[model samples]
Target: MDQKTNEEMLMFVEKATAGDKEALETVLLSAQDLVFNLSLRMLGTFADAEDAAQDILLKIMTHLSSFQKQSAFSTWVFRIAVNHLKNYKKHMFAQRPLSFEFYGTDIENGKSGEVPDLTQDVEKSLLAEELKLSCTNVMLQCLDAESRCVFVLGTMFKLDSRIAGEILDMTPEAYRQRLSRVRKKMADFLKIYCGEYGGGKCRCEDRVNYAIQSHRLNPKQLDYTEAGEIPLQTMLEVKKAMEETDDFAQNFAFCKPYEAPERTKRFVREFLDSPQLSVIRNAEGRG
Candidate 1:
């Protein structure tokens, strides 16, 4: 059977709920980066990020029954993230980790360790480790729970504000206001760090603009739907799908350049053995 958008995701969750360990792993594998990035930004410690990610996933597995599809699956997943952060914050306040490293050094007040030397022409932080820690922590400190949920959902993950609002139980207007506040705070941080988009300091805005300029967002630039690096069969399936959908080409263009490196060829060869994505690819062709 062809899995509609969100159908497969929900079925995957259902399998996990039924104690299908492999299905649970597949869900995590699909969303590992999303979980890790959110936790990393929210908690401000890689260790804490890992803990939070796992805890949230496990918690979701336990509470999968509560997900009645009231919102987009992504939003539902993120609501779990929001609740996890609240628990994490409570833990942080109860027992503060007095000494921590920023970019790899002990900062007196949890500031980002100085930005590493910039890319010769960029003159910006380039989202280096230190800069992420610094900016993320600054943002975290400023946001209350609702604001943080909105910020993480709307900005970082690029969820629609309406979806984010739904996840956080806020009115659309309220969500927009929170998003505005988050953007203002982000702008303030960037102004301080990069001096109005890297004039005197370094900024992520420059990096973002550069990415956009490079046409990185152009669908022709990536092949996300193609799922390259799979087996010959999956490759054929992906290729067929690529030929079928103009939208797939555009949407996946940014991912095409990411063909697996030779170093990981051996591992990928094994992973491509899965038939999981092949059905979707075939359906795309028929569509």
Candidate 2:
């Protein structure tokens, strides 16, 4: 989704805050992708991401009146999302074993059984991408929730330290420090496991068959990420797009961008069509 200008965002915020149901729907709808992506990356499961996205959207609507506008509307929305995910992670106890451990266990226990020979180059390439996304998604769970959030916001979403700090309610210095720590930890892991960072043995191509045998990669149903969409670049500036260079850690974190599932869009539309619409409109009439 394209970034909105301050003027454009303020207009939406004004209308939404005044309880205009259409404006409220537009504002939330524009942010659906952002919320869903963040939730999927943070939660590491489609079911959890969908649930979190729905809950976060509801929170955004319920708390729309409390948005003080001290920061950009996007930043405020992100603040809610980041905090919500952090809490949700705690509630869900999402800190599972790293992908490497899980894959190793599965392979050792003969859980994957026999590998199927995929002769088609097109099929191989697609599976390779899917494996990369699956591996990266699980690897992200290795970090603590705070570190994961910091790494994602700084590397994948490419938010600057100040804006990212505001989203997490931290000082820029603190955010940078946390991001540095997370970067170092992730870089170390990538250097050891990712072939792109080094000659790591755990190449995505090598894992495709294992992932398939283990039912992690279903050719018919590609989950976790979308096909043909470009990953979000390391864009720091709000208005200007920057060239993305190969930083070992950043590259690993950004291998796959989260794609909002169709279900999420449908949920938002249904929400806008619900009785909540009456509540927002009635609030507007009262105001």
Candidate 3:
């Protein structure tokens, strides 16, 4: 049944490729689900995903003429999907850190399954949840724009090193090497501040909550400090981008409210619920 569906879907793709509007729309409907999934995983928020999804569809329609069938139809669409998402991440990270999740002090040590000793515990389960949320926000904040982009794209999208590297315009080996550094830096940072989980010594079977990255660490290579580092000279550009983002958010209602909707907000919150997204925040009243 699934195979037959693919055959039918391909026929629609053929027509869409020939510039049939109805066929294009049908093919897009089939493809948009993947686009939405990519957006959700890559962007880590429902609001962001919806916005990215909408933009992708529009780009498909607008650039439909440019899509040469040198690759598979899905591949063409995915290329657009990848580009749109990378742009969105670059925009958001430049603006401000999006909120994440909060687990607890034992986050990175791979002890998530130990089941909280509620009855015999000091803090309630609610505190754990709050900490998880705070932790996620802080992690996002710590990630420089490129690091956040690479980690989310490689991790959530689950793209192979080669493909992920292709999306970022780098060779496969370079991509893996750089990715290793990004992951290592992020994991090391999270452990120190968020209270460590995922032992560097844990084997494949035991390292569950956080997989101890057996891969080599290359922090210096993946470090963006040399590129966009917010130094004394670069402060002006950083401030300008922040100010623009603030202005955009302030007037976001008039621009586009994709990420602000209730449904999307809930989706983002759910995505952030993962222990890894956890971060510490200085929010005063509402968490």
Per-model clash counts, in order, read: 14, 0, 23
TM-scores of the candidates are: 0.54, 0.82, 0.48
Candidates by TM-score, descending order: 2, 1, 3
- Is candidate 1 or 3 superior in lDDT? 1
What digit string (tens of lDDT, one per residue) describes model 1 on residues 1-287?
A: 11124666778878865656567656555444455556655665444665676667555545665678765455576778777786675344225432213311322222223333334453343333233333335335445555666555554444555666676788777777777666565555444444333223443343433333332222232222232333222111111111121111222111111222232332223433556435533544455
Candidate-wise lDDT, in order = 0.47, 0.69, 0.44
Of the two candidates 1 and 2, the one with more favorable lDDT, higher being better, is: 2
Candidate 2 lDDT by residue in tens digits, 1-287 = 33566567668878987767778777777777778778877877666788899899888887787888787777888889999998785433364445546544543454233667642344777778777776677677777778889878877777877788878889988888888777777777666657745445566676676776665677666674453343453111255322232355435644455556778878888988888778865775676
Candidate 2 Cα lDDT to native: 0.69
RMSD of each: 13.5, 4.1, 18.9
Please give, for residues 193-245, the per-residue lDDT of candidate 3 as tens digits.
44223333323223222221321112222111122211221111111111110
User: What's model 3's overall lDDT?
Assistant: 0.44
Error of 1 at 33 (Å): 2.3
Candidate 3 weakest lDDT stretch, 10 residues: 234-243
Q: Where does the lowest 10-residue lDDT sum fall in candidate 2?
A: 234-243
Best candidate per TM-score, number?
Answer: 2
